[model samples]
Target: GAGVSQTPSNKVTEKGKYVELRCDPISGHTALYWYRQSLGQGPEFLIYFQGTGAADDSGLPNDRFFAVRPEGSVSTLKIQRTERGDSAVYLCASSPGLGLSGANVLTFGAGSRLTVL
Candidate 1:
């Protein structure tokens, strides 16, 4: 099966600009998640989708960040009014959708590195 993947492995943008990052999850995986990792820090949960619905989105920092998983497969993270603080690595992961019953081991994509100027 194809593993999760992300594009633009690196992104450089000016402050206040908008950017959209994409993620493609593994085949047959129904649970997807997004997380942000700053330098020297662990990945922070951003949003997660179980099927077509977002099961948890509490980690979204602010209105500047948003995500969507329309078909319960591929997903995208959109950022608006980019700021230097927004610079970080955006990672996407997916699991077997069994929630607590499953191993919950998330297979992460390489991640998209965002740098705000």
Candidate 2:
């Protein structure tokens, strides 16, 4: 796809298991983000990366969740000790830049559905 891309569109895991979600953004995009959406709720921001560094990660629920953009392009989200409450759609987005001017503008990919049993 020309826009953002997410792998393993659907995932089912047992409680306490670990899972990883991947995202690939547009070629020239410099900003990437991860979001989580549970049933009947709005998407919640999880993390944001600019270039190869995490620009904002305060949204992450706890130390169990982490994300990385090793080369400033593709990113991966890792979840540890998965719980049923953690089940949600993981979304990936990218933009040309960050900050006030382009913060609201983003190209989002189809989310990854996760179910923890």
Candidate 3:
């Protein structure tokens, strides 16, 4: 992919349904990240993958949220038993490396909008 790409762009679902969002990252990038952005806040990091392994997953709010990068190129985020509080834009980003001091710039996808009712 030239840049990160996410599917559906917008999804509307009833509360308690399961949904899967996909992300395709830039080619050759070694790092991928998932984030959730609420209405008025910045993107909060949910998980980070360096290659095929999850290097950090501390931002996932609960057991209902999970993500995977099976082959290190594309990833999916699955939400189980979704809540109204889960309505937000899910963002995906990729970088060459996890630079020190948070200096690395992530090229972000437009994002998948998940709306729970």
List the candidates ranked by lDDT, beginning with the highest. 2, 3, 1
| Local error of candidate 1 at residue 65 (angstroms) | 0.6
lDDT of 1: 0.94
Error of 3 at 29 (Å): 0.6
Candidate 3: give the clashing pairs: none
Show model 3 residue runs off by greater than 4 Å.
Answer: 101-103
lDDT string for model 1 (8-117, tens) is: 79999999999999999999899999999999999999999999899999999999999999998999999999999999999999998846764778899999999999
Q: Which tens-of-lDDT digit does each residue in 32-113 have in candidate 2?
A: 9999999899989999999999988999999999999999999999999998989999999999898788454889999999
lDDT of each: 0.94, 0.94, 0.94
lDDT of candidate 3 at residue 108, scale 0 to 100: 99
Q: Candidate 2: what lDDT? A: 0.94
User: How well does candidate 3 match the true structure in TM-score terms?
Assistant: 0.95
Backbone atom clashes (below 3 Å) for every candidate: 0, 0, 0
